[model samples]
Target chain A: MKEVFTMWKNTKMVVLTAICGAVYAAVLIPFKPIPLIPGFTEIRPASVLPVVFSLFFGPAGAWGSAFGNLIGDFFGTLGIGSIFGFFGNFLYGYLPCKVWSYLSPQTEPLINHPALWLKYIFTVLIASLGCAIPISWGIDWVGLIPFSVLANIIFLNNFFVSLILGPILLFTLYPRFKKWNLLYSQIGEITSEKTFLQNIGFIFILIGCFGGLLVGNLTSLGHFTGKIGINLIPLIFSLILGTILI
Target chain B: MSIYLYLERNTFIHRLHPVTKIFLLLLFFILLLLFSSPLPIILVTFFLLLVSAFSRSISNLRKIWKLMFILFTFTIILWTIFLKNLNYALAMALRLNALIFTGLIFLSVTRIEEFTYGLNKLGLPFRVSFALTLAFRLVPSFILSAQTTIQAQKSRGLDLETGNLVQRIKKFIPLLIPILATSLRNAELLAIALECKGFGIKKKRTSYLDYKFGRNDFLTLLTIFLLYFLLLKIF
Candidate 1:
């Protein structure tokens, strides 16, 4: 949270934000037309960039991911989806460093310690799930795709790609950045205090995720047609949750 | 920089104000999504295709059509498997097609500068718009650097083509560093250049270009507004 203000005040961080955004869009635009599941699933090697950049540039990475996804959408899937895509990509690039640093591991380079690899995997999975939920859920609520299908597809797409490529890039870049003292973790202060607002934010996110999943399951099982007032409950809950987090 | 979709043509659609055309695109696109019935969706898709043809952007539209065809087929198959209704599948496919075509047609006709001008006139700050333009402008350099890096790595016997998913991804790591280094250097130079030009020196900046709302924009907006209501009444 403090890093965001730090980013704003620093000219170098501002320039890096724009550069990272351009790089992200450049990596993604080539893959825009190649849909793995045709309309829905995409083979985004660009998925790996977010996690890496998040760990590398911190808040700048998140802003870059948001803007990059917005620009990348112009290649094909733009309009309403871009709104959700922005937040979703922000989470994708944000949660990795947030969670990783929150866990408070003192490892210099993640590759130096084999045990920290699990943390990397865990970070990537959480980030991927965090990103997938908003995007798939938003698109489904907008009546574009089935919640279950899109959610699982996005989850798998981001998770596996990031799991595979994210580490390799991290491992490759970490030592280099560490030697250069360019790693975000090295320069930026990782907020360690668990504030009351953050706790409430996490609680809202938990409720949103659990409630949304239950709604998706119930809708799929024909228990509800997704039109019940109850469906909006989770959406509204997440909206509040999102507002808090932002 | 590779804004390859916008064809430099003198068609009437191309002549329409960027904001007006974007408004129509959004209106029709929303209408396309609002209707659940196959008839309206199909009608919207047809209308979009017709507009593309009328604009003489058939060649540009054809490129997107190829991709859209794949999307349509994928939608039909997926929906058929999940929903077990061919009619629903077809309708969903049409909706997806409509979404893609709307974007394609809009980008094909609107120049980047015109779109950015429209955005600026719509009250977006100059810095935000400049960042957007910078991102787009830098894309080709990033792509070129990526290509050069890949070529450089390939010459050193790195086989990116014949690897499994993990291996291929591993191959990409070598390419990432060079690209990042080059991009960072370029960003520094750009930042210096921008500061030298006295960016952010003034609170309010001005543009030389002005896009006026002519009769075509008015007629187009009115017609689309009426058509939206008319469609709602009919459907």
Candidate 2:
């Protein structure tokens, strides 16, 4: 988290952030004509760029993803809900590297082994959910889109695109980035220690995000009843607290 | 393929200071959200249209009218299906349209530099603002590179249009890899260039463009506040 701010101090990181953002927007803007949900989202195959850049550029990637989505929104979808879109994209880019660091600190982001592949899948799932929860909740809470509708679409879109494209991008580009000394690990000192607080925070993120999704779906679909199901403010707070701690 | 919506007009709205424009944008967003009923929302939409016309940004709106129409129709249909209420659906659709139109006007009037400068004035960090402006400028070039890659790939017998969604997406891999690689290489060069030019050596920096807080900005801000209160009272 500190690196997210600290990376701005380094000129290369700043340039990398801009590059990541520009590339993402470049890929994204062309897809604007093809809408999955008009005025809400599109067929965003460029979603994988953030995940891939996350593994390589770390904090810069997170900021890049956030800014890239903002730039994309400037095309048409720029509105009050874009604030959530910004944060959602930041999480989409931020969570993958953080989860990967926690899951396998020593190894590079390669997918040669079955265990590594499973970890990759889990990492993408968390990142996808991390991105979906806030945007869906915020939009739904704002009375624009339903929580159940958006949450599922965003999750599936991010998960499937990243799951398919992330590995190929990583496999081809990881070595090149490492050789160029542009990987976040090479540029910044990453602490490998697994602290107790970090483990707990990770669990909280899992529970809060997944639980919010489930509860949101159930309540919106009329499967859940009572006061607890009606209000999502508590879950959102937990999710925020989880990310902060993690 | 150009992403920028800014129209170079010498209208009053275009001449307003960046901060004032940003404030007005936020104020309109709040106003839109404060009302869920169709009548008030429609009024706001009319007001926004008037503003767009006065600002000479209606052409920008025209460019995105198709998108707005589709969004309006789909939102109404979706909400109607979900909530079983046609009036509610129409209201929601109008609300969404008003939001989009407001954003369109903002973008149409505000340049990238003005936007970043406004954020910087509003307490965003210089580095962040610089990166944002840089990213905005870089988008067109990246798009150009992507187009070149697509053409090169097509010449090499790559088929992008002949597949289902998944297959079409899979075809993008070849296109993406080359553009990404080139961009990464260019990033390294850019970083080195910036470092050589003493990009971060000074603690403070000056802008090339000098935007003054003129009387127009002040008047616009006051009018916006008054309009907001009046709308609140009327609603």
* Winning model by DockQ: 2
Task: List per-candidate RMSD values in Å.
Answer: 3.4, 2.0
Model 1 stretches astray by more than 4 angstroms: A1-11, A29-42, A105-111, A175-190, A209-218, A221-236, A239-243, B1-3, B161-164
Q: In model 2, which regions exceed 4 Å deviation?
A: A31-42, A225-230
Compute each candidate's TM-score over C-alphas: 0.87, 0.96
lDDT of 1 at A114: 61
Tell me the tens digit of each residue's lDDT in model 2 across A1-246: 778888999998999899999999999866432355556665578989999999899999999999999999998779988999999999899998999999998778988999999999999999999899888888876677777888998898899889888898899988888887788888888888888888888888888788888888887776877332246667777776767667
Please state the Cα-based DockQ of model 2 relative to the true two-chain complex: 0.67
lDDT scores for all predictions?
A: 0.71, 0.86
Chain A TM-score per model, please list them: 0.83, 0.93
Standalone chain B TM-score for every prediction: 0.93, 0.95
